[model samples]
Target: MKLSFEYGQGLMDATLPDTTDVFIPGETVQDPPFLPNIEAATREAIEHPMGMKRLGEQVNADSKVVIIFPDRVKGGFQADSHRKVSIPILIEECAKAGVSDRNIKLICSNGLHRKNTKEEIRSILGDDIFNRFWDLGNITNHDSEDWDNLVDLGYEEQYNARVIMNKEVYDADAAILVGHALGNPYGGYS
Candidate 1:
């Protein structure tokens, strides 16, 4: 049997045995209802997250915060995207907890993907956030190739390897991850 499936920006034709199984969200299965109010929902989730303390409660004055966001590959940055809405609210929470605006930093966690330029990051982050942090040099993309930009987390006995991460995240007193999660074959993607 032959079928067309989504691949990147378009679709591709594929041939498979008649018994092969194929499933797609909102196609083979019902799509979950869209959130009624994305902004409010995001705010609510952050302020009253499951099992975790409220964002504001975890931070305080003199705290240095690093907010890490997904890259363009993760598909955020629409007008009402979680990043656009949630990030500002997170900043507000930090501010409410007495963290200074200057102490807050935003990082694009690009991982193995190519480093996202400031312009590309702006597209993923929207104007208000991009402009707010960009000029202050508070927004930057992860550069895996830079030794000085990475922080060593020391050796992990369980994994038997050293764990390292971005220096900005390591340096912050409070590190926050802000991104979407997708259920997939790999368990989840963030």
Candidate 2:
């Protein structure tokens, strides 16, 4: 069987090495059939009335909410990365929950990692969502060095795990962490 793959700009014409293992989904698995609807699937995952109902209902209009997202740079770009879906979804849900656009802040969870540039943010979140937050000055970096803006969360007695959180995150009335639940060597369980 022949299949076509969409390669990014630089990778066009690149040939797959013989060591590559290609597995066809249906042929290999005994799972049910798959339905294809790109826009609908995207909306279901990233917009209201589908996956975000619970989160949307819990948020109160009067409270200040900070939505944290993992920096996509750490895990190179993919067509269906959670970083792409989570931000815009949170924004739409926040609007539905009666949260003011100004009160909702989008922050990159860079931690000690390199800061994400405007272009990177735009690439993570499409131009529309990026422009909305960028224009309002609501997007900012997580500066781990700014002690004045960080709060100590005490330490573990056994391992002495010194936990310091971002002030903006701690000070907010509520925090919504939007991250992909994947296994990692860092062992950050949820």
Candidate 3:
């Protein structure tokens, strides 16, 4: 068996023995049946989410809403990617709450990784979204080192972990995080 893996600026092809055990997520282990309409499904989830109020009930016209997305290395990057699809739906929900696009911001939660460039961001967010927010300077990459923009909300001695967060996220009236359900998208070690 042969496979082509994505490498630095190119592909790396490897040949594996037929006896080699290989497990590809959603392949070797089946995922649930695919949603026929991801956009509709996403909207439905937001409308009637469990354990929380609906998205439109969370904010208002004067609210500053920040949508946080994982950096380039995470998630699917297709035009119909989770990031691409879910973000628009989230913005629509915010709109339903009377939040204007002018009051909305997008941040890439890069953590310790190098910042993603405009091209990289555009690829991840798609042209329509990038165009909509880039001109307004509402899209930005997370800077963990920017002390002035970080909030250290006291240390948690029990967990031996400090609760540090980006001020934009902490201070926003509403903050939405788009990430993988199976992965821990928050907190990391330098």
Candidate 4:
């Protein structure tokens, strides 16, 4: 008998450390019956199971909703990425939950990193999702230096940590954080 391994780049690939951990999909785990569809599997892992009917249900209908996601360069983009699955589902879910299209905002969680260009956004979200949201000016960058809108979360004392967050996120009616669960060196940790 003979076997061969072919690795393809996906969301996990962006953040995967340089190592050799054979990811045998069905063969690696034995629990919770197999998922027949990749989209379904993606939903099961990323989106909330019991929270809102869709990711949109968590938002307030009268206010703006912000969806924060890690940059694609940080293990968030792929050829057939879950981010693709998650974003549109979120859009549809938001629509179903009565959140108007104009009220939804998609923000790349770039932090101190460079802003994502239109091309990068397209690459991360694909043309369909990009077309739907970008036209509304719903997509933007995380400007870490914008102190006027940042909220100081006091201090951690031990670590001298004065956590600050974007005021847009703080002022928004709701916030949806989307990211892969892969281990990270920078401690995004979600």
Candidate 5:
């Protein structure tokens, strides 16, 4: 048997034994069109956010904003991808909130995975964002191996695990996580 797997920019066929169990979402499930008008819906969501202050209410000229997004592993390259649609809106809102472009940074939370290449980053962020921030040194990826950029949250006594985060995110005045909410194998939930 052969099955198609979603890969970057395209799909790949994987051959498996005939007796192997294969599960496909399309067989028994259908994902409804959650938000048909992404831009309008995003605007509405920002205007009336649940459990948090609106973007304009929280940021100011002095605020250091950090916008984080996952790499090109999950979100597709479609024009309506979260980064493409929501980022411009977020930037506009931040601007209205008095956050300057120079004070805002874009970080790719690639985590332990390899840093996304320039092309991959471009594809994920689109031309407008990539061109605006790439040359300005305002766009970057999280380097888990860069100890200086990692902040230790101390050891958790209950879980016996130490939590760490990117220092940029740790030090930001405001941080926004923008990405899809669909299922992913790595996190079980996105």
Candidate 6:
């Protein structure tokens, strides 16, 4: 069996033993289309947000908005990619909420993963978003190694582990996470 996974700008091919059994999600799973029109679904979701008020109703002019998006490693770079389709809408809502551009920051939540390069950043976020935020220093990748940018939450006794998050996220008046649900090794979905 053979498989090809994306690695940087190129592809890395892998070969398994002849007797190996491989299962591809598309081939193994059969599910009806839940929401075929992503944009429409997103709009509907925004209209009736759960657990909180709408973006415009929640934020004020003085509010600092931080939007966290997944890195390229976890998602696709297609024209209709989640970030591409959703970010602009989020921004528009923020604008309607009177949150200025200066108060908004888009963080590529790479966590401990390798930092994405400029090209990868452009690929993950469409050119319009990249152009709108990158040059303004509003778009950035999270650096776990940068201690100053990390906020240390006191050790939790339940899991007996230290919890930490990005300082920008911690300091922001509102922090929103944008991502897709996919089967991953870390968990069944993220």
Overall lDDT per candidate, in order of appearance? 0.85, 0.73, 0.88, 0.74, 0.87, 0.88
Residue clash pairs of candidate 6 = none
- What ranges in model 2 sit over 4 Å off? 1-53, 76-79, 181-190
Local lDDT at 69 for model 4: 76
Q: For candidate 5, what is the TM-score?
A: 0.86
lDDT of 3 by residue, 35-56 (tens): 8998889878878989999889
Q: How many angstroms is residue 32 displaced in model 6 relative to the true structure, after the best TM-score fit?
A: 3.6
Which digits, one per residue and each the tens of the lDDT, describe model 1 over residues 47-128? 8889988888888998899999988777655688778888899999999999987899999888999989877888888888
Off by over 4 Å in 4: 1-36, 44-57, 183-190
TM-score of model number 1: 0.80
Candidate 5 per-residue lDDT, tens place, 1-190, comes to 8888767567999999999776656674665557778889988997889998998899998999999998877766778888888888888898998888888899998988899988889999899988988888899988999999999989989988999999999999999998777777677887
Query: Lowest-scoring 10 consecutive residues by lDDT in candidate 6?
Result: 24-33
User: For model 6, how does the per-residue alpha-carbon lDDT over 53-96 read when each residue is reduced to its tens digit?
Assistant: 99888899999999999998886788877888888898989999
Error of 4 at 70 (Å): 1.2
> Once superposed on the true structure, which residue ranges of model 3 sit more than 4 Å away at CA?
5-10, 23-32, 182-190
Distance from true location, Cα of 174 in model 4, Å: 1.8
lDDT of 4 at 37: 84
RMSD to the true structure for each prediction, in A, is: 2.9, 5.4, 3.6, 6.0, 2.6, 2.7
TM-scores for the candidates: 0.80, 0.69, 0.85, 0.71, 0.86, 0.85
Better of 3 and 5 by lDDT: 3
